[model samples]
Target: MTTLDNGTNSTPAPTLPAKPAVSMFAIGTAIGAILLTIITAISVGFSLGEIISNFGRKNSVVEGLLNPDWGQIWSRRSRSAFIETLQLAVLGTATGATVALPLALWSTTFGNPNRALRTLVRSFNNVIRSIPDLLWALLFVTAVGIGALSGLLALFFFSIAVTTKLTSDTLDGIDMGPIEAANASGASLTQMLRSAVVPQILPSYTSFVLYNFELNLRASAVLGLVGAGGIGARIEFFRGRGDWEKLWGLVVMFFLVVFIVERISVTLRRRLI
Candidate 1:
């Protein structure tokens, strides 16, 4: 080694290689994503525009809404029809929710000790959920004849499917630590679920129930389209006679009732969650 005057040979300072040209890659990716989003939005906008144009030409929607017959809505017959709608919703939701509780519990692995049983229960729940409410209403209407009872049955099945799905999901998402603690303290499965899981998931359960109630209200209003009963029947009656004013009045009344229910649901949900 050659010795320098003062000393020690030092390694040359390592030069940092120039950073790879990643900026171009990042910019290109961002540009591509933006372009894709723009294209998608334009496509959706065009489709919506076509729909709006079609609706405007028909004039059914706007005419019905703007020239609603407020006098008809305030009439005794209309009020009675509205009340029937409310009754169908309330009774249907109550019965459905009651039935759903056991199904929801059975559908979840947390409640079902046997894996095979859990799978079977979950499959059954899925089958129920796959059927749309309108289809259910149509089927029940044929079976029970066109009346409020048919509407109630349709709503009941719909609510049960919805509640079971939601409740099972809520149960699955619950923290298991509390449940384990309860079990460790010599609690039975039922006791653990009642004391620990239920408390944790009650808020979510209540919220789902409220949501189902809102859905049931809308469903009840339209059930009469299939002759299942409620204001839907009244709407269909007027529609057949070409009484656009009365039809519009029923539509407006439905809108008002749904709006009120929505407000109450929101307030209750806020307090809950």
Candidate 2:
């Protein structure tokens, strides 16, 4: 039995090396972010104190809020001014969005039959967007002699910038399979877009248009500051006359309009998105 046991000698199992512990990269990042936040807080606190001390001497902030002019808000002229602002926003948004649809399609690679054409269209769109709407309003006011037309023109261009960018992005993210299938079935570019892409992105496009309308509403209210014809002109008039009561009413009206538009936009976005 001993002779038989000597024929087979058992070997020990090999030991596997342990893995090194993971580094605390996440913790380090957190610490760095905390330090940055502390620095930013200190800077903001100092700036806020300076602002408070500067404004405290005038006492305009307290007087403005505590005793707003409710009577002036109910005046017929004020109501008319508010209506004019709304009309300007609505017209501008409608016109801008309508024009933007074609431009958006042209700007996208998918809609462009030729690569060079697509590049050109995209560049033009970029150029248009680069110019601020207020500047456009100023130029138009100079040309059109300071009226609602100038405000309308400004809002229209602004809407185009917003709508085209959003629509092009939506077109870019669409499912390619449908596009390919439409092409395979001998669909024309117009047919393919109408049948495949438009249907899919219509909801998002509508939502964006609505959002732009809300923005235009706010813009129209200020367009009168440049003599573009809206509540902004009234605000300027009251301010020039030193009628703080009327000015306060205009401010309240502006706030109310903004709040209402925001609420509607939020509700519509929620439903659409």
Residue 34 lDDT, candidate 2, scale 0-100? 96
Model 1 accuracy (lDDT, Cα):
0.85
Q: Which candidate is the best by TM-score?
A: 2
Q: Model 1 reaches what TM-score against the true structure?
A: 0.78
**Candidate 1 wrongly placed segments (more than 4 Å):** 1-61
Which residue segments of model 2 deviate by more than 4 Å? 1-50
- Residues 1-273 of candidate 1 have per-residue lDDT tens digits of 223322454655554555567688899999999999889988877576788789869666567777878788677887898899999999999999988887887777667788998889888888889998878889988887878888899999999999988998888788989988998899887887788778898898888888899999988889888888888888988889888877887788688879999999989988998
Listed per candidate, the RMSD to the true structure in angstroms reads 7.8, 8.5
What local distance difference test score does each model get? 0.85, 0.84
Per-residue lDDT tens digits of candidate 2, residues 146-199?
888899999999999999999998888889888888999999999988887888
